[model samples]
Target: MGGLRRAALVLVLPAALLLSGCVATPQEGITNSSSPSELIPAPASGAPTTSAPLETAQTSNKAPVYWIGRSNDNAFLYREFRDVPDQDNPVTRALRVMMSQTPLDPDFFTPWQNPKKLATSISGENVITVDVSADAFNSNVDAAMAERAIQQLVYTATAAAASAGLIDSGQQVQVVILVDGHTDYVAFNHVRLGAPTSRSAGLVAPVWIIDPQEGDSVGDGSVKISGRSTAQGGKLHWEILKVDADNAKTAYLNGTTTASTNAVQPGLFTLSANLGPGRYEVRVSQVDASDSAKELFQDTRGFTVK
Candidate 1:
């Protein structure tokens, strides 16, 4: 994945012109705030216990896995679904993927390297605690990058725990990091690791292209582009650009689509685009109403039209 690269073009249109009367909102689940009362319930006292081989517990299940990717203006974390090995503790498995530094998308990446061992357990308070080997602190990034790295772990663990039925869906979860079982260590020599961290979609990539995944081929003339976002009022902008294979040149399609999402939680947006047989790149973005050129969140995925 290290050697993969591709070019992208972002054309920002004036918010007033593009957003006028284009508010088609969709219904979505409400995202619950992280609270002690909302934590995953621990096993009941005196429950019967059974032992199973770790090998047997390694069954495959598809769940969302997030990675860091770059847009024309910003670098943000986004998610994609992948098969993970089932286990008694799904949060640990999720964290393992985060630390693995391998993403299915070549454009995405992780800063994790060396001494990647990690252990996770949910506390009675519903706070998940992650203990990492000393080697986890090997990175030398700045403060902002360090913060994003921590959130990546938090988001992965919380999402995994929710998927495993350990926590309720849409409820936020918190995480605490301990280096070698000690909370005194600092991450990347910048941010303190002694405090508990919670999920913040604001810190993550705001837009996700869930359908027509990277390099997919669609026979239908129309393709549905869908994903989640945290933009204000759940409003997002999308455009399709036809890419020329010979020179990598791109031409804008007919018109841009505006999709709406739930404001309180991450909202789902779906839009359909009709195109002739060709190769194209679909770009979705959330532009700051105050500054059209300042893109708060954006993502692009290439697919084939057959």
Candidate 2:
């Protein structure tokens, strides 16, 4: 909190919705059977061809369609870092460390999904609120999971704000997350942890690497962008945005599905996109399945196809 001034408050969210059965993932990129193979081909250098419907588009014809990058970079980050934040910044350094170990669930992340949900503020005596969702305490996520989640907010926020930093470190950080907001049913169960709290994970890296391993150049056909997540849980959404300029540099689309629970299990998703030939930024977000804060991690990698 020394070098930088704290922000008043900020919020962020995930970009996803519920799915019926299990979400299908393409595997042309990764090794998981659950994921689908992405179809992202290299854009070709040529003039636009406005051909009439040769053979009406088919329902099953998987193709890679290229488009333009509507917006650049993460909108949430743009707001927090670029926009005017309160003098007391409450999300910095340490928080990134905790998230590296265990990513927050995208389902609960509110900022992007819900702009109003504020995680912390600098106006008052550094008020901190932690919201828990229904799936916050899944069978697999036990004592360690709960402990880490709390610590992440505490360490990260305190490090960002000044007053919050003065607050008692040993005292528990107050949180007000929902148990089951999505479902009509609600069950509140206490998540107990071992006596001595373990130290949060060391500075963790949230970057993911996505690549089009499948033979490039599927001209207006199904291609693939394969890569790996630091861990798992977040669904795999894709975007193929193609930016048309004097330079055929940027253009692509995107697709994704969380790899948690039945709706979006830990796996892959196959999508269809078309590109002529150009540069692309394949952005993949890895949000936890339970954390109220979504977009725990995002990987925007560059790729080229023949």
Q: Which one wins on TM-score?
A: 1
**Model 1 agreement with the true structure over 17-94: per-residue lDDT tens digits:** 232333323223211122111221111111211111001122247555667787654566777666666553566666
RMSD (Å) of each candidate, 1 decimal: 17.4, 20.7
lDDT, candidates in the order shown: 0.58, 0.31
* Model 2: lDDT to the true structure: 0.31
Question: Model 2 over residues 1-306: C-alpha lDDT tens digits?
Answer: 333333434231210112122233432222211111222111111111111011112222121111111112211110011112333233323232222222222211211111222233332323333333434333343222233333334334443332334333344333222223221111112232111122122212222332442123333445565543323443545556553444354434545554322223223333445655655546665544454245544545444443
List runs of model 2 lying over 4 Å from the truth. 1-207, 213-220, 246-252, 260-272, 288-294
Q: What is model 1's C-alpha RMSD? A: 17.4
Backbone clashes in model 1: 0
Estimate the TM-score for candidate 2. 0.26
